[model samples]
Target: MSEILHSPGVLALELSPGATPSSFTLGREAADALARHIADDLLRLLPAERDGAGADQADLLVLGALYDSVQLLHPGWPLFAGLSELAHHSQALAGAEGGRIVAFGSHAGAMPGDALQPLVSDPPSPLLLVPWTFSAPEALATDLGARMESVFMAKGEAGRATADFLMRTLGVRLEHARYLTRHDLCALICSQLEHAGYSALWQMLEFALLYPTRSGEASTARGQKLVFRDGAVHCALPVYADWAAAFGAGRSREERVTDYAGWLFELRQYVALLGAHGVAVRFDGDAGATSLPAQRLAEPDPSLPPPTLFSHEARGLGVVVISVAQIAPDRRVRLLAHAWPLDQAGFDVGLPQFAARYGASEQLVRLGGIELDATADDLAVTLPGPAMH
Candidate 1:
């Protein structure tokens, strides 16, 4: 039982950006090339599911880092609407069970100097925007460490107190209960103790058992010395089967098992309470599985003129690349472009213009009229700036 409690399985997935081809730029050729690549990857990654079947047969899906906006390629639609539509489609095809989607966005503070302020009010999607001001990696790590330590100490003390109470209530000798750790003993006590009496016993043990300590040495005239300890002494007694049997006669074994199980439940509740109060105790089975659907777009007709490219320069600063991807049955299509630096010097100034150019290009593709719906948001693209000279 103890061994089973100690071992649990967990799975982790990390998504990273793929390499950009040297020929890639903020133009039609780059957009078409990226779109093709993304489509291929998504098809390979997401398994096609049969209708009326449960996800039990489906594989787990984890989205590590998803960026870029397909709406940027087709400015005619609302940005968030496009994103939502795409998410819906992707989740439907992927099968929701055991799925997780974690998107990465730059903390606004990470932007150059004061460039973050203007964008603060109307920040991008909550799922997409992680403000730089609040997302310091080093700071978050340090705080998490402190929180974990505090939680560990609190849980340890609680377990010890619970164990001591069990020993006293059941009249079990401390020596007989030494085989169990404080946590195990606590679990045993909770399982065996009456619900009505458990809280009082817990409070009593807490008030009397946990505290501070001191020690002193006394020397006799003959030079023999002895040590005496004072202040506070904290100790926990072990749990014994006899104490459990004493609680009920006919079903002693069943009662003992029930008591143990009850204790485990209470301990879990306590942990959750601590978390609600901002204590960071790590627990298994705490998070829910989530999924986002892929995006689809209508295909464009071949008779239309080749898509035109719009270029934006950021003065002395490098290009702000924007790429978008749309998901289709056979593959994921992407759109690539860049924002011209606004000589006007405000965060909101040139963004809409860049979005418009990108969006129009996407609309051209959709008009070609492919049978498959290229969910607009299903596409993924990158935004790499100019190389630092």
Candidate 2:
């Protein structure tokens, strides 16, 4: 069987972290202009060939959305397949092609339906990516890929006219516009995560992106460990047996629970970050234990029996239930807790409501979690903000 080949690439517009854009996409005329500029830049960057091995033969497909790099890594919607299909259909339309450039603008009569809609900007890492492709033999494809990667890294800035036009039309603060192979885009995202103090977590995330067939493990400085495998992130919650032996063994139960609360808060932050990156998360009591759906930690209700204690409820009741279970004869037990919904508004306010209704001592033992006795007041503790790495 002959091997099938597809060469797909993306040109990214990376904005400063704090930079703001008024619109997520461009209007028709502006989109067309940007597409033209991309074509011109690529033609100048890639040498012309008699056999059409240059940018002249390439296809540039522009979309009207800012993208997060992780969205590009979605296994469900492989980037090359999606872009190629879009380009194929667009190219077949008699008037849609403009010398190898096709822009998917909001005002363009051919807007994709919601199901096929691309991922839009969130918190705005705000990469306006224009994906391009080439049809060539395997060797020519490899050579073209190398040269594009090299030249784009060296001098891929958008032309002056293009930059000005983007700023004026899209109302964005221009930072740096560059060409990136899809791989380069992933590296750029990994670099940004490292700079943002997620260096430890980046390794697993990168593996989830590039090495989906294998598993990867990593740990945060605070001792939280995570593994990426089978298309989801399985995190070993901090209050597990091994972690307790190292950090909680000598501490009082109250102190241990307090420290555990802090760790639980940090886990929430990680979950939010992963969600932003479009990755699924699950919980593991130990590094090698059977994984539990992350929702168990996200919305816990220990009001039921032992096994069902960790089962998740559809709606979060605005409090974390630290459910305790005995697993051994030596007084060893497991403590499972969840964090408040960080995404909801007035969540902190819900904290007080929970405390007022539960009372201090009555609910802890009744809930089948830790028996806080008279000091149950501590269970309603206010968690601190995301800890700085």
Best by TM-score: 2
Report the lDDT of model 1 for residue 9: 9
Residue lDDT tens for model 1, 66-168: 1122111111212222323233344322223432221211242231122211122123212111110011134332332233233322332212332343234
Q: After superposition, how far is residue 208 of candidate 1 from its true place, in Å?
A: 14
The CA lDDT of each predicted structure is 0.25, 0.55
What does the lDDT read for residue 153 in candidate 2? 75
Backbone collisions counted per model: 51, 0
User: Candidate 1: where are CA atoms >4 Å away?
Assistant: 1-250, 271-389
lDDT of 1 at 29: 28
Error of 2 at 246 (Å): 3.1
lDDT agreement of model 2 with the native: 0.55
lDDT of 2 at 68: 54
